[model samples]
Target: MTSAYAAVYKEWRDDPELFWRKAAKAIDWIKAPQKIFDAGAGVYGLWFPDAVCNACANAVDRHVEAGRGDQAAIIYDSPVTGTKRTLTYAQLQEEVGTLAAVLRKHGVEKGDRVIIYMAMIPEAVIGMLACARIGAIHSVVFGGFAAQELAKRIDDCAPKLVLAASCGVEPNRVVHYKPLLDEAIELAARKPAAVLMLRRPQEPATPTQGRDFDWTAEVEAARAQGLFADCVPVAATDPLYILYTSGTTGAPKGVVRDTGGYLVALEWTMSNVYDVKPGEVFWAASDVGWVVGHSYIVYGPLIHGATTIIYEGKPVGTPDPGAFWRVIEEHGVASLFTAPTALRAIKKEDPAGTWLQRYDVSRLRALFLAGERADPDTIQWAEKILNVPVVDHWWQTETGWAIAANPLGLGMAPVKYGSPTFPMPGYDLSVVDDLGHDAGRNEMGTILLRLPLPPGNLVALWNQEARMRAGYLDDFPGFYKTGDGGYVDDDGYVFVMGRIDDVINVAGHRLSTGGMEEVIASHPDVAECAVIGMNDAIKGEQPCGFIVLKAGTSGTHERIEKELVQLVRDKVGPVAAFKTAIVVDRLPKTRSGKILRGAMKKIADHDPWTTPATIDDPAVLDDIADALKAKGI
Candidate 1:
């Protein structure tokens, strides 16, 4: 009954029903629902039964009415184009209303789906909030996702309308995404009616016949028609949005999140975890397509009425590494949230910079990193270089908002550098073994959330992929299995070790190795291939492919290798492609022809688990080892 770990969520664990309802008081709800629970004893959440509320209205409307109208909601920048803009609470309300009116003209009704294909521009947030305001679910595909990846999502959702930009700005030159967007539209069977374009980069884009029209013009037309109506009232459990997780499975699983329960959790997270000040400027360096952006960038900041910075360009592009610091100084940014992978990239590009010295980031008091655990070196680098404590928060797409956070300003939990600290106000977190028994101090096992799913947790899966309930929901009965292998130390700090299933994390991106292997093995010359993660100086782990060609494979080493790599690149985009590929005469295998990928990694990292189970062809394993040893990688 006495859990030292869950000092916060202990109230909820004792009487979960009461805790969830009590947590609801944290937010300014439109119509507080009649009941938190619909069914009986063992059954859990149906948060606000038939309650009518809007996510953006919660974010924009309520905060302004609370007399925070002049507070900046988002500080936006397009560094590549040398543009800067800021939206206050009042400004954001107008933008959302205009865009919501635009969607209404395009027939985006309450249950309609709108796919937003834009970079990390403020308009992306504008578009998303617009959809939320009108009760239409918006799915934003990450801009970097290849045409094929985009196409698959488009086909899956079959969204009513699409909101995209004419071009995108990265760190370097302008990336003309129109070509790829056009190509993807060509591929989709039931294509979107029209492509609304936000034309600013001016790249001489000839519209694609009747299917294409200007984005700004359409919104202007909508403004002429009438502003968006008051938020579409719905039950708290009504699906607000559906975000697809990056490829951890063959098919992307759509995580449907509702309005009320989600906002309750996010509002609590912004207040308790970050201890956000109303006027403080907050920047989360993530594209809206990812989960981090969804929570922190859009919902969390607005919930707290903080100035959320949305940078359209990559950090490096804005005059090298000085860009982030400049924004902090310019916008008077109080807090910044980002991933370690991004920090590593910036550090690699600008180690000892004139930028750091020239820029004033005194306004930046705290830093936060999520998506993956922060590397100790990066944490120290942030503290030493920026002279601010880097607060690390850990949670998954399923758990929604900050599950375990090192709340520096709020709770004064001492820093563990790379560790994910204590659970939030309403999460019953436990580390358990295979048999469902709890793990003791410092014992590593699966992280389980004994459920009545947490407030921010995924409610249900989308149509066909609803079977994921078996992969997730039914596993531990009431408890939602996190499926990650992690451990809780004596200090109550959490360190995630990787996924139980062959899900690999390459530079903080979660994906399936078997998913890639399956695509690679389908190639004609490739009889079989096993992908293994090799520790890289830059990326946390670089995936490498070891292959044994089929019979009568005769192409030269250089030629065949290039083709194989291309095959994978085409199959699953550059992200899933192997960093290195080794062609061996025969792969190390058991008598049953199982490739020993673990042994392959043992060449780079001499760990015991990296050792293969048992090899029938041990000599073949030696041959592959000799090849990698020669390369010294």
Candidate 2:
């Protein structure tokens, strides 16, 4: 059968300019682009080179103008605060307009940078849209980020204003954001002119008299005066947002996303990749601070006129292991996207699949996983337990949208155990060897994309054009190096092994830690695991596995460790050098649930390493260090 995705892929590849032009029509642009793509403009490919439009108009106002005013735009579900709020397109427009006016009154103008340091509340989305409405570039720092990290972003971007909340409600405790914001303000070299504070009613906080202004007061006053900021027409290449991503060197790189092309790419993904129809409920369980939330939860769904759920709850905490299932049941979510780490946690909490039977997940047409590599064991477990096709897709902070996915919206592809399906329509992905030559099928190599890159890709690093070129472009000449090691099978299904740096060289043999972790996780006793390469005397590097056992699993540490070692040997090979496996109570992870593999690698190597600011729990690092010292590795 000629699948819907195949047809679109063929059309897009056949004539990319015509394909993108037709796709761009889905958006309501003030000035339609004369040219679809301009690849001759340096390394950063330009999309809609001559177009002028407002991202806020396409995301919110267009739906209201087209008589979809009553349609739900955002559904705020915060289990921690026991709050539920739904904003229709009309209501959202009013809120965004009022806030936009407040921003203008505060001296924020076009091309100004605004730093948003708020919790996962409706105001966060409002702030982003408001910035877009007034043509200000927004950079949202995760609410849990430390003051030092926030201060770094402030200094780098030199934002004109800082939008923050008093506190964020979590299941265990309340996180005070105001104190951190105040500290960051003091620490920042280039301070913002004003800090707008949103008060959470549950935990009321008073704002500073001179520096901080109450968001509610400002918005209400603007509303009373009947003042609203008009959408500013910006060039297609105008930056929409600057999101900072961590590099291997520990310094963060600010990835710049443009306005016009981002909208077109996300809108297309909402329907084609997510299989979501207009007005259908879609939920991407991620924070607005990350790229996943920026693309799927906020922009993609909204641009497609779909109801997006902004969930402020953990997969386990906010209630129980069934929180995600309950959300799908309550909201009739047609598409549910989340990280593989989250699913692994859920599975660990309820290994018997008890949560699956409690909720009626029939409304869920598909379950998507991203943010990291999805192991075959987890995918199989999720599929069997949920009885839904568990689609694992691949993307990056630089891409802004899915690069490879199953495309269930077009036609359901047969689920491959570890592969993230085929490359999306607009991307030309290939695996390259060390010399930048194309590698054979099924042979692992660095992933590269033939330039010019597709729309929605990062245009340049904020204030670091040379760094952007050196980091991504210079490595492979004409190709954009993805810095990921993976291979495509004969059937053209790409299976991402892991980051290229994560590949371990053991005695002249290369082994992927991801592949080894997958084998270890397949063990019944193991809940989750991370593998890192440690320096050795004879062998170049030795693989060390850190295992987190499933709840109530019975086994001695020594016995289970030996079993895991043998399991890796049997599955991967004898040359894998999977010598040691240590059972730990918990694995270090970020607030977003990504394992701190780099930190673990440092610990394994017995090198001095500082705990990352984004780590969810610092105690885990101590545990890892103690374990490594005891083993005398």
Candidate 3:
């Protein structure tokens, strides 16, 4: 089949303004934009600078007005709590309006900031929409985040109010969120005016006198009085939300997304990238705190009038490895978007996909992997078992959407093992060497996006415009440095090897640890793996492989380690100098499933390091340390 990708890309490249202007027609605008783009506006430029719109109205009110009120808007499936609930558009509209009214009653106005620190529940989504409905900026901190980190965000945004839940239910324990929230408030320099607490039956919170408000009581009162906050018109360049990047150590950079361009871009991607029609079930198994949840889980699907799922459970442990399969079967999910780490976890627990066979996943047409590099081994495994196209796309927290993707909705290109095929419509991707010149075909270098980043991408850092320019623009003149090291192959496929820091110098040769990891993961006995460069006295740096064996693998650790060393030498060549390989039970990762390679590298080098705020489990780091010590490194 001939893919329309080439012609469509050309259409965008030839006249970018016209393309985006056409896309903007799908959204309902309070004041239509006459100026498509204003290069003199922002840190870079601005899109739809003269337009006025409301995100909540486009996502909720308009859908209801269009007579799709009976369609499912959000499907909340929490296996941890044995709960299943679905809210239709009309129902969601009512709840969102009530919450908006509550915010208005508390005096939150346009551009005021509100912080949402709740778990993966329906209210969390409601809080975000409520903020948008009244033109208030919402910043969602990851649930159960460290108090110090939360305090830092609190100080940065200086929110007028905070919305939180009492507790977060995990498979084994109920995490008390109230205490954490209180502690953070105590630590913060800037205090919120009020706190709205949602009391869960598992763990109810004590209200602070004259400060805390009950969520149920507030909403009920608002409904009884017929008080609902209507959508407020915001400038096209107005801030919608502030999301702190998870990987930061000190003060986190709050990525700010604008209203007009974000809606247009997300609406375009719904049919052009995800290929799901209105009312179709789309599930992104991610927490609302992360970029995936912000884009795919909340705004993207609803703005496109599709049913989105809020899954609160592990990929493997909610019941078994078949948990995701059951959700797919039950919800009739057309597309599943998640990190590759989730798939690796399921594959490690059930290598043969025995549990998957028990459920009918025939309704799932495509599986989209992002947030982490989708290794070929995991992708091939998912394709073999699910019998669907496993598309690996690439983007970042700053971009808010895919920079390079296969464009599944445009047409499926021939699958390449390691590349995220072709840059998306807005990104003009190029690979440059140390001196900022173009790199040779398939040669490793810093990947960059040409100037004037596409719509839906970050407009600026919250209260830090100078920092934004220094971090993204100053490094490369006229190009946005992606901070990722990769290459563009002769076929125009973009291969993101890993972060720029992941490239290590072996004597004089620069090697990509991601490439070595890809080779290590190809072993039949290997379920998951991470390759980090360890400092070496003679070679300057040497590659060390830490691997987790597949479930029920018959090979002994010693034999498999030897085989892995040989495999890297054979595939990546001896120039890799890949001699050490350790077999561990698991790897350290963040809650969002990104492998904590930097933290692992810090531990491996015996450098002073603190536990990452985003780590999934701190105990895993100790295990990694023990494994490294036993190897006599």
Q: How many clashes does each candidate structure show, in the order listed?
A: 0, 0, 0
Q: lDDT of model 3 at residue 545?
A: 92
| lDDT tens per residue, model 2, 1-633 | 245777788898899889989989998888999988887764657999999999999999999999999999999999998889999999999999999999999999999999998889889999999999999999999996888888889998999999998988889888988888889989999999999999888557777778899999999999999999878999988999999884233456899999999999998888778889999999999999889978988888988999999999999877999999999999999989999999988888888889779989899988999988998888898888888778999999999988899988788777788899999977989998888788999998999988878888899889988999999999888788998999999998998999998998999988899999889989998889999999998998999999988878886999999999999999999999788999888899987788999999888887888888888879999999998887886
Off by over 4 Å in 3: none
If scored against the real structure, what TM-score would every candidate get? 0.78, 0.98, 0.99
Model 2 clashing residue pairs (backbone): none
Q: C-alpha displacement of 625 in model 2, angstroms?
A: 1.3
* lDDT per model vs. reference: 0.72, 0.90, 0.94
Query: On TM-score, who's better, 2 or 3?
Result: 3
Off by over 4 Å in 1: 1-7, 39-44, 225-227, 350-354, 464-466, 501-633
lDDT of 3 by residue, 361-444 (tens): 898999999987889999999999999999999999999999999888898899998788989999999999999999989899
Q: How close to the true structure is residue 264 of candidate 2, measured as C-alpha lDDT? A: 93
TM-score of 3: 0.99
RMSD of each: 11.7, 1.3, 0.8
